[model samples]
Target: MNTLNNHENTNILDLPNEMLFAIMNKLSKINVLYSLVDVNRQFDQLIIDSFYIHDLDLTRKSLSGDISPIDKQTLDRIICGKILPRINDKVNKLTVEPLSIERIFHAVDYAQLYSLSLVNFSQEILLRHIIDNAVIHRLMTEQITCLNIQVSDKIRSDFSVKNHSNILSLILFIRENLNDLTFSHWFIGLGLTFFMYKLSSTSCVSSTLTKLSIFVNTFDDCLFLLDRRLESLSTLIINIVQIFDTSANIDNTKLPQLKCFSLASYQRTCSYDSRIVPLLRRMPNIEELTLFLSVIRMESTYIDGIHLHDEILIHVPRLDKLLFSITTILYNINAKIELPSNDDIQRGFIEKEIYQADSYVINDPSK
Candidate 1:
């Protein structure tokens, strides 16, 4: 009876605004708005507040770690029917998967929206909506400043590389104020599949984009993007499927405006010295640099701090932050050469003032 009385006397409305927000933060925006919006005048007013309505994620997450579009019933009754119609102007960012995208966009105009993420749309479906749908096309060209595209499994089954290329061209050229962009797809077992795009002389260029995160097929494709066409680009994050030595014919101008760079290659490469080192040498004004690489056949020498200091770090004088995860696998090991210990690797980094670096040695006797 005492416990029952305590529960009955406690009122959630007595909690402060911060406490209410904290509770809402633990719940989905959809659930918070749907459950609280019509409960009372106070709850309705709270749902309309900028803190609650500014960034809306309309995707449903499963316990198995899959993300999909919200169901039609919730979209109809709560989001489109009640919430969006009430606070569309306050929404600054919106994320939607394929199933809910058309319905939500057709329901109301997010006039204040600047960031949009379209997830799990196939190349065809994505382009059809952006190119054929007048409202979506207008939103992309006129309003959106940041866009993230995560293509669906349809991309894997579809063999039309032209459609993929067209998607890239449309995004880079048509968007008006787009400052940041991420365009990639995740493969089921193989990991990220880098799309191959060939830039052309007649292709339209974007003057507003400052940041880009993309996946490409080759190192030469990286060169094609840095060809002064994206004149305002100051930050680049790229993942290459394969890194190989490129011909010296491409433009090799210094990237003075590039302030940050991140390069990740899941595949092992032998061209770190030939291709990667020279590429890092181009970014003279880089304030931050990150490298994730798996290197093979390095003439039996690991890429220790000494090799990093001598080949790469010394060249970039302005760089203040360096984060790297590099693995070098040697072949044809000589029995006479004594392999460096984990302690020896630490000393190399300590001598260069990189005291936080860590190292370990893994030897596969069967290999």
Candidate 2:
């Protein structure tokens, strides 16, 4: 054991600089490398020369917080001189928080690249500045190929209008670039008429988008916003939460190329709305279906007796794999059922029979 330990230690010490650099890249966290930089001058030089600093994580390091002017200048120099050039070709993903659009634009301009994501960005001026400015226009025209915009409904009412215009301009930009796009946090009560209008009006859209995911706060919003046809999309994932009242029917004829579909709902009450049945029946090639009901309050007689059984299981016949997860909490009114286990519902009635027949045919056809 002592000889093996000594040999391993010697090998680590004798490892080539290139091998050490590769190992450092695989550490998976920046803090580990930071620690190694403190160990020896050789390692410090390795870290600095590798230009790993090109991936600036301003949010993670809290560099946006108030700082001394000298420190800020020094950081800016490091980013502009050492980081930006290395990132010119290699960096593709950029995430910006809602704090300040000016900071985001400044960073993006310095980076001279696109494929950006704005998370919970509620400020209108920042968005307007991007759309109105020439520098951003050039950047979007040349470099941007993927865009993600996230809006939170908890902000002030005015934020919604700002978000709407920003989305309109963003959609227009994507229509021009034909980029892969994702829209998160599609809350209810936000006027989506403008979006719908633009989507319907686009004549020769050349979007390279192959995947689209939308998260809606209510089923009504999902039905409304998702009612349009996306001719080029090949994969779609929809997540709805806390509200299941829908009158609009899904139009699947618009999405003929869809090969993957995922539907998930959590902490919400559900019912057997007749509109959803036809929608499920229309998705003829769906390979997987997952149903998750969590922290559901069972009060409405519409959901309790026969609706859940009929609406959830009896529909969606094309699903090759079905998964169900349910969670409920007891209250003073009645003893509520706990969350269902991983094995609660083995298979729906038809699924079980199909599985048995397939198993018998595969194992013993003569029998």
Candidate 3:
């Protein structure tokens, strides 16, 4: 019996590095680091590998179905006391929430850190801990190359103008060494959704930024972000809350460097011809385009493949990929207008030699 038990029992250290790494990949980085670090000389050397320490997510992991409760005391003790100090230099990317942000940054100065993700931080905490703090500001401006910001606060009923200015200031502040950015703030509750952001006229004029994804309040706001000052911007993705004609005519500079563009808006626009078509024409050399738009047609029929081909595709000679989800809401004001069937939409696609197409038409008399 003793001999049989000895044969069945195998030490984890006996596993090869490849096998150990595969096993460690299954657990959260925190769990892996906490459970494995300081076990012995071999485990310490193994856990120090860049694969284990490169991207450290310090935020609390989602606890949907775990049987054991997270021991915050133990986690704080292990991470702050043991793990971060040893692996700080190897960390290239770090993600943190409000609770752990100060503690994590205070433990050590990550010399090789280039990317940072701030999640679920309130405006107050963000301003006090990160934005206004001198050390964090220097780290962001001098070292960070990629940044992602997601605010947790909901829009107040009496949303103050100071709050708007603070947001704009925050965006302007984090503009020195960044190459990629994704900034979004939205809250969905009580059968309502809010995503309100408008770029200021004096936005960042960076030559190094290559990709940007942001949420804007209006189509004009979207146009504001596509400033000629962003000389090296090659990819732009925007989710607009509303789409409409601008009140004033702005600069219509050709974006030759913009190789890819994606625009999504849930609200409907009646002026697709005047506003949206002209906007697409600005990107004369675009290679890839994606649009998710709702059109409220007042006098015209649905915007089909032919309209896209003539209006958008004809302008961009290099466009090799196109993906769109367009919905046209038709309303009869004076007379019953004839609307195209799904077959008609498909025929248009076939005529354009666009084989990959999915079209649907829904008629709602209530609207």
Indicate which candidate wins on TM-score. Answer: 1
Candidate 2 Cα deviation (angstroms), residue 240:
2.2
Q: List the residue pairs that clash in candidate 1.
A: none
By TM-score: ranked, best first: 1, 3, 2
Tens digit of per-residue lDDT, candidate 1, span 1-367: 9999988999988788788888888787777876788898877777789887798888877778588667788898888987888888999998898888888999998999999999878777898898898988999989999999987553354454566667877987789689999988665666555445354654536788899998878887677778777888999999998988755574568999899999999999988887888889998899999999999864467889888998888989999999999998876455534667888998999988777788988877555
Give the range of the ten consecutive residues with the poorest summed lDDT in model 3: 188-197
Cα lDDT for residue 9, candidate 1? 96
Question: lDDT for each of the candidates?
Answer: 0.82, 0.49, 0.76
- Using lDDT as the measure, what is the rank order of every candidate, best first? 1, 3, 2
Best by lDDT: 1
- Give the per-residue Cα lDDT of candidate 2 at 126: 43
Q: What clash pairs does model 3 have?
A: none
Candidate 3 regions exceeding 4 Å error are 1-26, 36-47, 63-72, 155-164, 167-174, 187-200, 332-338, 363-367
Q: How far out, in Å, is residue 351 in model 2?
A: 5.5
Best of the two (1, 2) by lDDT: 1
